[model samples]
Target chain A: MDMKINIAGVELDNPIIAASGTYGFGHEYNEFYDISEIGAISVKGLTKSPRAGNPPPRITETIGGILNSVGLQNPGVDAFIKEEIPFLRKHRCKIIANMAGNTFEDYCEMAEKLSAADVDMLEMNISCPNVKAGGAAFGTNPDTVLAITKAVRTYAKKPLIVKLSPNVADITETAKAAEAGGADALSLINTLTGMAIDINTRRPILANVVGGLSGPCVKPVALRMVYQVHQAVKLPIIGMGGISNGDDAVEFLLAGSTAISVGTANFTDPYACLKIRDGIKTYMEKHQIKTVRELTGGLIVESK
Target chain B: MSYQDYSCQICSQQEIAPNIIACCLENAHLAKNAKPGQFLHIQCGDPASMPLRRPISICDVNGDELTIIYEVKGRGTKALREQTGKVQVLGPLGNGFLVDNSLYKRPAVIGGGIGTYPLYLLTKQLTNASVYLGFRNQSVVTLEQEFCQVAEKVTITTDDGSYGVSGFAITQLEEDHKKEVFDIVYACGPKPMLRAVQAFAEKTGVPCQLSLEERMGCGIGACLTCNCETHEEGSAHYKHVCKNGPVFWSQEVVL
Candidate 1:
C-alpha cells in the first residue's frame, strides 16, 4: 500500500507520526524498535530555555485516557539541537521540532535558531494547555494566534505547522486565524483542558490543579474540529487527538487531515505508530484504495 | 529502551494477604532482565475497559518465571486480579537498585507494606543483610517467611502491636543499628517512613538507597509526568521517577 503523505511539500514515508510531548527525541522508544519505521517523530515540546516542569503528581488516569500537566519540560532549543538532534539524525524518520514559548520573542528566537538546524519541519505550539502563562493563552485568542504565527513565520525557514488548541469556543475561528497567519499546515487538537480529583484527600489529583486530557476520550471532538477546520481553511491538516489505531487514523484522513499523529496511545504501546501504519495499509489494501490521497476527505455525508 | 509488550502465561496466583495477591508469570526475557528495584507495566482488563497499564514491582524471580505482588487499590488493580491464560507486560523499566557487595558487608533493608515487594529481590541478592518490615497490623503483614529465608536477621513491626514488635519499623531499625553499626541502609515505604529513614541515614553517616514511588504515565522517559523534587546546587530540580530513577541515593532526593 502507498502510505506516503505530503504536508505542505514535506513528504512522509508513511502517514503515522508520533505526536509531540508523547515521543521523546526518539532515543527512548528506539530502544524497543527502529523508530525510523514510523512516518516521523514529533520530538518533545521545546522552549527558549530549559524548564523543570510541574511538581509531583503531574499525571492522573481517567476512564479512557490520561490528564497531564508536565508544563513543557525540556532542555531548551539549543540543547535539543545539539544533544537530541544528533541522536535523531541517526534515524531515517522525519524530524518535526515541536516548540513551546512563553512570549512572542521566545517563539521567534527559537524559530530563527532552528531554521538553520537539520530538522525537517517546525511545529509551532501556541496551544499547549498545561502551563499558566503563554501556552494556551495565545492559542485561545484569534488575534494572538495570527500574531504569533505571522511573527514566527518571519524566521521559521522550514515548513511551519501551526498546532491548534481544543479549549476554544469555536475551533474554526482559531483555524482560520492560523491560516491567515501564513501557516503551511495545521494540527489539532492539543489536549482538552480537564481535571481529576482524589476524593480521599479532597484535593486535585494533579499538582497543577488541571491538565490537558488526551487518549481515546478526545477522538470524537478532535475529528469534528479537523472536519470543521478543513472546511474553513485551505491549509493541509496534520490531525491528532486520541488516535489509537489505523481506523482512527482513517477517520481523521476522511475528515480532511493530510496525515495523522499518534499521541497518548504511544504510552499504552510504544509500537502504536507502527501498528497504526500497518492498520492503515491493511484497510487500504482491503478497500482497494490506490493511494492514501484517495482516502483523504473520503467521508460521504448524507443530505436530507 | 523501547518498551514492548510480551504475552506470558500465568504460572500461579495466590492470595498472600487480605487484599494482596502474588501472581507468577512465565517469561524468560522478563525473568532475566528484571532487577531488584525495577518494575513491570501490566496491561489490566480488556482493551475496551482499561486505558492505562498498572506498574507493579518484581516481587520474586525464579528461573523463567517472575512474581508480582499487588494490593487491590483501585479499578485498575482490581481489574488485574481477573487475568487468565496470557497477560501483556512492558518492563524491566527504570534504573534498578545498585547493589555493590564490596561497599557494604552488613546491610540493613527496611520496607513498609506494599513497598516491601520491591525489596524482596534486593534482599535475596545480599549475602547477610538485616531485613526490617512494617505493616498496619497482623492481617496485612506479608512475605515474613520470604524475608526470613533471605536475611541473616529479620525484624517485623506493626503499628497496633497485633504481631511482632510494636511501633514503627524505623524505630526498631534505629534501635538495632546502634549495636550493629551497619555500613549501608536500603528503604522503601510511605513518605514519612522514608523521611525518617533518610534522617537517620544522614545523621549516622551511612550511605542509603531508596526506591521511590509515584503516579506515572508511559513508564518511560517520554511523558515526564512522574516527577520528583531533587536538590542540586542550592536549587531544586525535577527528575522523572519513571526514567531518571525509581531508585536514588538517600541524599539525592528531597522526599
Candidate 2:
C-alpha cells in the first residue's frame, strides 16, 4: 500500500514532489510530458517584490554539478498568483507555493496574503541569503529560524514547509528549531555555495563571483544530512540535492526522507521526474519491496 | 521537441582548415524546415562536465541536412568535436533571417568574418542582389561559391589585401552606393562591424536591417532574459532576439 504523508491536515497522495526553483511554474515541462504524474509541483521561488537577479553569467558548469546564483529571480507574489496561478490550478497535482522574505515584515506580508490565496502549501524559503544581514541568517541559527517559522505560522493557516539551508553548523539542530517553532514539515539542502574561474580571461566564470552548487556531486552530503536530520526530528522531510534517477530517490527514501525532489537533471533531460518516478517502481518491484513506506528508514547499518 | 541523434558523414565533417570545423545535421524534417539564421542547441556532454547545451547556428542546409560552423574554444566545443559522427541538435530554433520574400529590386548583402553565415540564406531569398563580405585575411573567408550562385556581384574584401576588394565590406558598400541605388541593406556580423554598418547606413541614407545575437535561456517569450531594447515603446517594451526578432530594422534597435 502507498503511504500518505499528511502535513498540517492536508494529505499528499505521494511523497515525491518537484522542488521549487527547478520546476518553473509547472507549465513548460508539461508541454513535453504530463504534469499530473508528479505528486506535487513547487513553483519557482516568489518574493514580495520582483527581482532582476544578478547580472550576466548566472550559471557555470562544475566538476559534478552546476553552480548557479540566480538570486531568487521571479515575478512578485501578487503577479504570480494572478498570472501563473490560473494555469497551475487546472493541473491535478498539488501546488507548493515557495515564498522567500528578506525581512520579518516580508515574511508576514507573504504569509498574510498567501493564506487567503489558492495553494496546497506555503513553503517558507528561510534558507535564502539575507541581502541586509548577509548569508542566510534565518536558517543558520536556532533563534531566528524559530522566530521566522512562528511568525509565518501565526497568519499562515496553510501547511508550512520550512526549506532549510545546508550551509549550517548542524542540520538536525535547525530541523528541530523549525519543528519546535511550528513547522508542519521541512525540505533540506538548498544549493551549496561554490565558485569557478575562467583561465583564458583570468576572471570568474560567474559574474557575481560565487554561486550555489547543485548536482550529483552534492548527493552524498545531502543524503547524509537527510539521514541524520530524519533521525533527529519527527516532521516529514522532503530530501533533495542531486536526485537524478529512481535508485537515488530510493536511497533518499531509505535514508528516512518522506519525499525527494529532482533538480539539475531536469535541465539536461526535461522528462526527469517521470523517469525517476518510474525508476522507483521498477526498483521496488525488482527488489520485491511491497510498499514505498516500508523502504523509508530501511537503511540497515551493520556494526563495523 | 523530440531529440534524435544524428551521425556526420565525411563531406559534412570538414576540418575547414585546422582548428575550425563544420558539422552537418542529416535529418530530413529539420533540414526541410530550417531557415538560415536559425540555430541548434547541441548537447555536448553529460553532467559532471559541460552540463548545459551549446547553441550553434545553421551555416547551410542542403537536401535533408543542415551544417554548423564553430571553433573549439572550451570543453563543450571539444566534446562537440568528439561527437564528430554522432552529433545531436535541438533546432532549427530561434527565428532565422526573415527572408525578404516581399520582393525587392536592388539589395546589398553585407557580411563580416563568421557573421557571413545567415547572409547566405538572405541572399538566396533576395532574387536580384549584390554580396559584399569583409574578413581579416583570406583564410577566414567562407561561402564564396554559394554567394556567387545567388548574387550577380560578390565584392569580397580582406584587410591584408590578399583577396578581391582590399578594404572593409562596409567601405565597399559606401563606394558602390555611388554606382547604383541599392534598395536596401541586409547584414549580420561582429558588433564593431554592425556599428560601422549603422554609421555607414546613417551617412548614405540607406535603409538596413540587422540580426543581433545574445545568450538566450528559453528561446521563447517566457524568460525575458534575452531582450534587445527596440525603438518601439510602451507595454510591448523590448524586442526578444529569440522570438520577436534576431531580425530587426537596423535603425529600430536602441544600439
Fnat for every candidate = 0.65, 0.17
Deviation of model 1 at A138, angstroms: 0.6
Locate the minimum summed-lDDT window of 10 residues in model 2 chain B. Answer: B1-10
lDDT of 2 by residue, A258-301 (tens): 77887776765566788888888888888887677677788999
| Predictions' DockQ, in order | 0.62, 0.30
TM match of model 2 to true structure: 0.86
Candidate 1 residue runs with Cα over 4 Å from true position: B1-3, B233-236
Q: What does each candidate score in C-alpha RMSD?
A: 1.4, 3.7
Interface RMSD list for the candidates: 2.6, 4.6
Model 1, span A57-163: residue lDDT tens: 89888888889998888888889999988989888899999988889899899999899999999999988888854368899999989999999999999999999
User: How far is A121's C-alpha from truth in model 1 (Å)?
Assistant: 0.9
What pairs collide in candidate 1? A31-B2, A32-B2
Candidate 1, residue B15: how far the Cα is off, in Å: 1.5
Would you list the C-alpha lDDT of every candidate in the order shown? 0.88, 0.75
